[model samples]
Target: MKTASRWAIHVVPGLNSFAYGRIAIQGDAAHAMTPYNGSGVNQAIEDAYVLGRMLTHPKTTMETVESALKAYDSVRRERAQGVQELSLQLGRLATFTEDLQLQPGADPIAVTAARLEAAGIWVGEGDLEDDVRKAEENFTKFIAKA
Candidate 1:
């Protein structure tokens, strides 16, 4: 990152099919990448949450599963790629290179971490399942009122 001016890299998903197994890996396990945009886990959580919803739905079918997976692939592929690209960008700008001397003020790692946390990726040590359940309960209450 310090050696160059403009940085970008596309963090690709590693064997995404790991997500569709009987006993599957969740979050970063199935698809891990840099914390460039901070949405990896948040996006993963979104991925897991959505998949859980789909699998539990009574209408789920091979066709439906395939279709949903396609949609998820479409969305997640870009997300992972984008994060990799951004991390590359930060690496270029922040890291110290042989040719250049850095002032040592900006913290790219923390910045990236903060961004990811905001996206609800890691959630500052918070409980993701609890949040999801609360959301469901809130929706149920709203529906009841309506």
Candidate 2:
């Protein structure tokens, strides 16, 4: 096996929104997280999915692109940031980092295992269709107000 001389993990602070005006950021650019839960790519894909839906809506136009981007931000920001935080917490738990506080009588190994299971469940427990629908609704409302 080839050994590399250096390794680094870079993460960005979570943001409240991923879009500003017509320019929207997705993937690692928006929410960078630790690799503990292996969710970075998944979250990026989700961002793309929602943004794609918003931008492709029949009613979307140059005049309303900003609203589409805002709708994308509204639907994706909270969920992506949540995954970012969960990924960070999983990293802490996996490494038994001091960031996690064990309750009295709590078994460290068991706790980590439980958290891992929950993360797996949570990662798989959302409806992409529902998310797209919500983004569409938000885009429509925003366009109406413009």
Candidate 3:
């Protein structure tokens, strides 16, 4: 085997997960992982929240329910992974004690400030309910192909 220069491993803590749509899968049965930033548990909890909402909705069809679940995946995945990536990026700076990688809209601050500012913009976009609803409507009408 070729020798690799670096290796990293993650230890996933136990947990439960659930989703809605004509069906529900719960607990570690749905998702299982330990994030370096301790976000895994919170994300799993969000699943529990939306899953319950989906279950209680009368308009919930296998299709609609599935759609909601897909929405949840899109939203939650972005939120959780975004934070996780930020934390990992931060760890890199802390470990290296160097300047941040400059990219789009990047400024000349130290790595930590740049990272936090970028993270703020990533997270500061608000009115999530309205945003998702607008996005879904747009997808259904304009963007989606039959």
Candidate 4:
């Protein structure tokens, strides 16, 4: 190659919440992460799906929208933050920079492969419907308290 360029990966710090009152953030706006786990888009989609469900619930209305958004935050914040952390861990593993937390005499390669596989399993499996249901339930409870 005549020339080569290096690009830096940027990640957003994981936030405590994704919504405030009626305002909410999704995708990279909320939890930007490294590409090692390739889960940024997926987490965004999950955010959208859950928020959409909250906004469209029959019990949701102008007066209750803020609560709905808060409900979305309650449901998605933890999960998205978790994925964000996992993505960073995967990046460390991919770069061979992670400590790997090996035991005495453990094979580094095998440990890395096992860790990668565990991360893959987490990335690959989820229940979006359950998340949406939980958000809706939270919204209902919030409105009930009002």
- TM-score each candidate: 0.41, 0.90, 0.49, 0.93
Local distance difference test, candidate 2: 0.88
lDDT of 4 by residue, 1-146 (tens): 77768778788897878888779999999998888788899899988989888888888889999899999998899888889899889888888999877889999989999999998898778788888888888888989997
Query: What stretches of model 4 exceed 4 Å from their correct place?
Result: 1-4
TM-score of 3: 0.49
For model 2, residues 1-146, the per-residue Cα lDDT tens digits are 49898779898797867888879999999998888889999999999989888889998899999999999998898998889888888878877883447899998788778878998899889998999998888988999999
Clashing pairs in 3: 15-28, 16-27, 16-28, 17-26, 17-27
Using TM-score, give the best candidate's number: 4
Full-model lDDT for every candidate = 0.49, 0.88, 0.50, 0.88
TM-score of 2: 0.90
* Whole-model lDDT, model 4: 0.88
Candidate 3, residue 72: the lDDT equals: 48
Better of 1 and 3 by lDDT: 3
Which 10 consecutive positions of candidate 4 have the poorest summed lDDT? Answer: 1-10
